[model samples]
Target chain A: MNINILYAALAPIVAILLGLLYIGIGRKIIARLQRRYGPPFYQQYIDTIKLLAKKTVSSHGVFFSLGPIMGLAGSMVTLLFIPFGSAAPLLSFHGDIILVMYLVVIAPLGMALGVGEGSNPNGSIGMARGLTLMLAYEVPFVLALFSVVLYTHTTSIAQIVQSQAGEWSLLKFHGFNWLTFALPISAIVADICLQGMLGEKPFDQVIAPHEIASGPMVEYGGKYLGMMVINHALHIYIETALFVDIFLGGGPVWFFIPATFSVFILSLIINGVLPRFRIGQALKFYWGVPLILAVIGIIYTMVVIK
Target chain B: MKQKTEQKKSLNQGGKNMTEEKSIDFFEYFIGPQHPGITGNFGVILNAVGDEIIKAQANPGYLHRAFEKLMEQRMYLQNVPLVCRICVPEPDVNEALYSMAIETLTGIEVPERAKYIRTIVLEMARLAAYLFYFGGTAATLGLYTLPNWSFGDRDYILDLFEELTGARIYHIYMQPGGVRRDLPKDFTKKLYSLLQTLKKRIKEYDGIFFDAALFKKRTKGVGVINKDMAIEYSVTGPNLRASGIAYDIRKDTPYLAYPDINFNVITENEGDFYSRVMVRRREFEEDIKILEQLIDKLPSGEVWNRYPMPLNWKVEKGDVYVKVESTKGEYGYYVVSDGSEKPRRIHVRGPSMTHGIMLLEKLLKGQRIADISPIMFSLDICPPDIDR
Candidate 1:
């Protein structure tokens, strides 16, 4: 129990560091692609440190103070529920995938509540768009999640990861057992939903800098923004790790690192080139294409199970 | 309860049904001089519901420096330095237009070589401005890679300007009778190589930004100004051409070395944000073609004719309006001289007077809040031009 507590405490710190590193590297890659010298890889760490060390931070009320704390808490809680690798299922329980899914939403909800208290129109607009986007991507995301759960016949994230460890006869051409190969349709749908979930363009309307002045974070500053940065880092790690655990067959630390980093870099590459979709267009796209694909994947999974 | 009833009664009397509850739904915000999304020191006061803008009011004068009034006090030659301050992006156009106005009023003929050089400088400025436009428009749409590419490329043009004119932004090159000096050694060769580099880079730009499907989806049919609306708004330059009007001041009026150079006025019929951007994109190529022709046909003569002593240079008592096709639109300088060392009055007609103010306000109505910046950038509304 003490070891588990220590692991739980260590996991969020590691996730934050990894997420920050990912963002820094992503920025460097994007900069090189644009033919410019980007900031150092540790730039985000410096920024977060500077923000946290700042003396004064204006507050909007009790809720405003609570927002970033809540967001950080939510991300930390979600990270704990998921298995980091095959060894570190720190706080997992039966049916924790459903719990993790619901817990993942608390960060944005906390942000919405906090930004609502701040009462800036841009922040409000950002909150609205972020929630609307959540609604849009959730349909396909849930379908994809359900397809995986049904195929593996498990709701615990640890069991699901364990189930995809070895070779399976179905679509075992290369002796691959990852769901990405087994349920290719669901994997693609989930990857598409991941793009939206990560808030990369062309679905980056929630924090579109040019459009709504970075939306929900418009009014946040000092420690509030600093906390958000940490929350964001952990969020990135959680989302990518979740994708990896479900589809890529979560293994040891070495495999997990490269698999999650590659998934993030793929999204980053897509983010670098595409212009943002308007909120309406993004909704239409998520509903029209990925939703249909997710449904098809689910039907295929059910038929395979039968 | 009483105040609510009064508010409801007044709202009902205005026209449409608007309850106190419903009226409060309209969220008003200022996208301003401090905002990153905004271009320059400009602001737009928008009344919106959710993300859709209901009304937009152009808020100008943030970067205002009373140039016209300042010009009234300075001598003809002294104002040369002052005129370029009106427009920061394409300062050469202001200097050329101001000089041309004085030249017309004083009857001091500019040398043929000086005219060609001025045209070359103007075209280079246009190319630089278009490059800036690409960066700004792409950035507003959240595709930041193009900005880094275009801005880095723009430095080459600025390098060429620095060699000839001794400054990157505000050159103050054009004098009343001619340019400040002749071209530097191997300047054309350097310029030619830069153009070639740019020409090669344009394909890469097209691949990344111009031809991106999402860029088209975001920009196409957004902020569309029909041909009739274009005419009504008095939109000129690439914007007017984009709206199906093939009229170009350079082609129609035949200014400077334009008569000698062969080029087509690039136009598009869509008149939307996409076409406006496309019109500028194609015009960048046209500008390159014009520069190439000007370089080939550059005459051998004195680049400047010596004007009178700077302190005592007097002009004839007459008014003249000299206009040039700037990268933005028709930039005109209306100068009235009272035969004194100091001119009587000077009026600068920057294109942003229409584009930034009235036209921007009209175009922004019913547009999504996300499109505000892109639309503003596509219009190429420089706040300094409006504020000047």
Candidate 2:
């Protein structure tokens, strides 16, 4: 019982720390890819702590404060369901994969809504752009996610991981077939595109400083801006972790460090190389090419795996 | 959900116009000050009837810094650095125009080497400024990669400026009689190579952004202006060139070393946003060619004039209005000298005041909200010039 209590308490702390680590490492790798000296590994943590200690300032409405809180809550909620180190999740339940996906979206959605409630026209425009981007990237992401479930034959994330363990790992289970491999590759591309939509460099259209001067976050200042920084770090962390869990098997303790670093470096390389897609183009990609590929992957899985 | 639907319906229906008599509803829309379509810190309050803009009032001075008023208080020499701030992007033109005005007033002839160097600097500045214009125009059409590429390349040119002028954005090197320093060893050779590399890369830009079908559709016939209206409104640079005007200050009134350099004035007869973009596109080639020619013909001579010391120097009591073909348009400075350390009066005539404000307002009228941004970009008007 005491062990269970400790697990409950430490689970959030460990998961949150991992989330923070993911952001720190991801930033460093992206910086390196862009030929820059990225921030130190603890940069995200320091930023978060700094934000929490500062005073919050709001321009238009109380919803601005509520937005970052909701983002934090979404991260915390996702952290609860995702299993760590073969341990049982803090709040595991049936159909939690869908909940995890929905939670991934909640942070940006809340931030967009809160920014739209502001009086600034630029802020509203930025929010509108962000929403358009959300619409563009989300559908392909959902389809890609469902393909993983179809292959594993379960919606429970832990069971999916368990299915990938050892000799029965999808790579080995499918004899490392090139035809089967296309599913994850397509999913990975979709994830990278989605990450761009999530507001990193190159595809940072919503908050393009030269064009709109930080866009939706333009009106936010002081501690409210600080919370935004923390929220962004958490969002990146969760997204990176989701990629790791989906494509990469939840491997042993020794593999975590290298796997984390490798996945992070891949994301950074992608971010550094590409330029942003306009909202319209992004919509076309998500609804058009990626959707077709995702359907193909799902149909292939249904026919072959069963 | 039901209540939200009802609220949305009421808002769209104007709260009760359908069930009763037709109310006089003159739709007034505030188009900017912070709208995505507006270029800088400025707004347009428009009263429209359907798709046509009936009444338009420009609420400029959003980025006003009172630069003309500020210049009146500074010394004639002190005004050099300050003038560069007037148009932040292509600052070399400001420096050149001001210096030429001072030279005219003082009756000082610049050294031949300094003249060539100034010409080179001016061309490079124009290229840099046009690169920025191309980037903005591409972005407005939702073609995003070109901006990333252009901005990255422009920084390389800024490095050259830092080496020559000891300042990146505003160079105070161009003074009354000549330049501050001579050319670095092999400067022309290096410039030639960079131009070669740029020529190769431009084709890539043409492939990705310029020739893309969507951009073609968006920009082709939008924001059209003929030569008559362009001349009447005092529009200049590529904006004027787009209206089929063959006039260029370099050709019409040859200043500095332009009489020695052979180059054609690029113009397009389309008189539309696409034509404006195309003019800049062709001008980018012309600027590179001019730079290459200037580099090859550079004569060996002293760069600076043996002018008197700064403290005792005074100009002859005279007036001169010198105009230069800047990246944007005709950048002119009119000076009145009373033979003191400072001038009695100085006036800057920047194209952006005509193009960004007056011309932009006129061109934007009756245009769709979508076309507004690309039209502003194609005009290539710098906001600081308008504000100054």
TM-score of each: 0.95, 0.78
CA lDDT, every model vs. true structure:
0.88, 0.71
Model 2 global lDDT (CA atoms, 0 to 1): 0.71
Per residue, candidate 2 scores C-alpha lDDT tens digits across B104-130 of 777788988899999999998988888
TM-score of 2: 0.78
lDDT at A236 for candidate 2?
A: 58
Grade the docking of candidate 2: incorrect
TM-score of chain A of 2: 0.84
User: What's the lDDT for residue A30 in model 1?
Assistant: 92
Please report the candidate that would top DockQ against the real structure. Answer: 1
In model 2, the clashing pairs are none
